[model samples]
Target: MPNTGTPPLPDTPDNWPVPPPPRQEPDQPEPRPGPNPGPETPDDGVPDVDGPADLPPNPPRVA
Candidate 1:
C-alpha cells in the first residue's frame, strides 16, 4: 500500500485535450423528420435478401 504508479500515455493523437467545441445549434430545432420507420421494408411480394437464401433488394426508400 505504498506505490500507485500508472499514468502516462501522450505521444501522438493531437496533443489530446480537445473537448470544448461541440455546440452546433441543437437546442430544440431539427427533429421534424427523423424518428422511427427506418428498417423493416419488405412489401411488394417480399423478396430481397440475396445469396445463400436470396431476398435482399427492396431499398429505394425506407424512411
Candidate 2:
C-alpha cells in the first residue's frame, strides 16, 4: 500500500481565530426608579393564578 499524508491545517492562533473587540452601544437616559407595579388582579381584587384544581395529573410516560 502507498503512504498517504495528512491534509494541511488551517492558519489559526491556538487553533482559533482572534476575536474582534467588543462593540460600543449608544448610551440612553438612565431609568428613574419608582414603585414597581404588582401583578394584575381581577375586578374582585383576586389573582387568577392556577391552582391544583386547574389541570389533571399528567399520564405516566411509556418506556
Candidate 3:
C-alpha cells in the first residue's frame, strides 16, 4: 500500500494584506488665449481674387 500526505490548507481571505485606495488628481485650469490669436473667419482678411465664374470652361475631352 502507498502512503500519501494531506495537501496544505488554502490561505484565508482575512490573512491577505489590504491595498490602499487610489489617489485622485486635482482639476487643472485651461490656458488663456495668446495675444496673436488666429482669425475667426475662414477667409481671414484676404480678398478672393478669382471666382468660379471667372475661370475658363474645361476643354472637350479628346476621346
Best by TM-score: 3
Candidate 3 residues 1-63, lDDT tens each?
455686655798876779787876658866776565344434434433332233345799999
* 1 against 2, candidate with superior TM-score: 2
Over 4 Å off, model 2: 1-7, 10-15, 29-33, 37-63
Task: Give candidates' CA RMSD values in order.
Answer: 17.0, 16.3, 12.3
lDDT of 1 by residue, 1-63 (tens): 655696667787786777898768967877575455455555545543431324555679967
Worst 10 residues of 2 by lDDT: 45-54
Q: Which portions of model 1 show Cα errors greater than 4 Å?
A: 1-3, 22-63
**Candidate 2 total steric clashes:** 0
Model 3's TM-score against the true structure: 0.25
Inter-residue clash pairs, candidate 2: none
